[model samples]
Target: MHPLFADRPAAGRALAGQLAVYAGRDDVVVLALPRGGVPVAFEVARRLGAGLDVFPVRKLGAPGHAELAMGALAGGGTLVRNDQVIYSLGIGEETIAEVVAAERRELARREDAYRLGRDALDVTGRVVLLIDDGMATGATMYAAVDAVRQRGPAQVVVAVPVASEQACRQMRFVADGVLCLRTPSTFFSVGQYYADFSQTTDDEVRELLRRAVTAG
Candidate 1:
């Protein structure tokens, strides 16, 4: 079993330790990418006494290859795409438009479901800590950073349990500080580092968000 997933909460607790400086800072907010990132962020948020919430992003998958994201769209109109991937895949403009449109709808739905009557936390002039379980290509995270930047945060910090060295480097340019727990020289998929990487369900995401909203 990979060390990152010896236990899910343990992994998060370990990550929290590395982020101790941010503890008890009211100006620091932790925004986690759902669904896998929520559990990890929960531990960090609890330890730091920081507010936790979800930031939804949807991949603009290539035609017939849902796992291959040519681009991604995050809630708040942030869009990031790898044109090379689209060109290599021969994805047409119409197809790309369709995928982005569909993804936007899904992103909005998730935001509505997770946030409900609660208002989005104002990021302006505050330090934002973006958390994810792990990153592979980082396309999703790039879009997320762009989305958060649109809100005019005072600073953006990206924290993750594990990621490829390349992904970590790329993310550093987009964030003020990057807190990556592990950056293996020979990296594979993010799942390779996790023991119980079971898919997180929508119901679980909703419940977690509900709890976060109530607690904050």
Candidate 2:
């Protein structure tokens, strides 16, 4: 089968198409999980006439299983752990604390680099659209939703270009709504659906956020 997207921008546009119901809304805010999600959310916010912001979240990978997310930390100080994974692997508090400390530093660094002194947009009493390029385990989105929920958003929606079938289903339980353009049962990785899945650089993320601010 052909790839679903040429790149992140294409994926974003496709996602925006499905979200046409939200067009011209003043109370909508799109918060992207950077640095990849910025490009995706930029197009969604632009197309929907919504505000754009980055919701920095850092995944805590299981020790020795770097690709497996055991939990995540949100910018708003919310921590989400997969207790099943933690207990199954016998991960202790000392290990968890060490990982949290390391991820906290990285999360702060990314927030500073992406925001550049800008304050987060207020989502109180408004619809919050949490976007990401893709979801593997849904750990990051769970943490983001948990953090954002505390701030009193009227609604929280999780959107992605493509995701594993299981991940999309899990999100539906937490998010007020969930929209995924593609959910392949045989999903290997997010990059598989994009023809040009290049790594999104920090410079690109910063530039996109700058443009989003200007666009707003």
Candidate 3:
């Protein structure tokens, strides 16, 4: 009915409320899927008094239909493909490789720009709160969850302000805890639920990460 969030910061604060159980835990870390997720994660990390960092991930949207995710690429070569989309669309392996190649370049560029020489935060034996603005097909978030899992985090928690009903269900299998503040069955798009779904910039992400790191 009403707008679920005023903006990314509002959504992040709402998400942080859902994640209050993690507040003040030294072993907890919030990893954002920049650049949109950074704002949200910044609020969460601020509220929870947790370390914050970026976990770069790029979505591989299907050719000719860029909104439809065929797969995603996360750091450390972790990839999760939507086989149903790929098979149904008859997307070839070469196409997949090409998409991955292109996205990897963007991912690397984002990591470099966002981190600005800071090393990726280590998640070993800690609780990793993997946050995003929202989830549609959950492709990119799924890949991020898998990539973080490999680094031996004690737990992986997927948290978002809103998501499709299917996505909320899907993430349960990937993370130790999945927190979706709203799972609308009639969801049209993540942006539809937000009053101001503005584009998040690299500068904004870097600034938030700088504040988080400096506060830590």
Highest-TM-score candidate:
3
In angstroms, give how far residue 187 of model 2 lies from its true place. 2.0
Clashes of 2: 0
Instruction: Kindly provide the TM-score of model 2 when superposed on the true structure, using C-alpha atoms.
Output: 0.96
Show pairs that collide, candidate 2: none
Compared with the true structure, what per-residue lDDT tens digits does model 1 show for residues 1-216?
A: 445666456667989999999998989998988878888888888889888888888767778877667988998688898898899988888888888888888888888787777888888899998988888778888899899999999999999998989989999888899988999888867778887778877888778767766777
How badly does each model clash, as a count of residue pairs? 0, 0, 0
Evaluate residue 55 in candidate 1 and report its C-alpha lDDT on the 0 to 100 scale.
88
Model 1 worst lDDT window (10 residues): 1-10
lDDT to native, each model: 0.85, 0.92, 0.93
Candidate 3 or 2, higher TM-score: 3
TM-scores, all candidates, are 0.94, 0.96, 0.98
For model 3, residues 108-187, the per-residue Cα lDDT tens digits are 89988998998988999999999999999999999999999999999999999999999999899979999999998798
What does candidate 2's lDDT look like per residue over 154-204, in tens digits?
Answer: 999999999999999999999999998999879877888889889999999
User: What value does the lDDT take at residue 62 in candidate 3?
Assistant: 97
How high is the lDDT of residue 102 in model 3?
A: 94
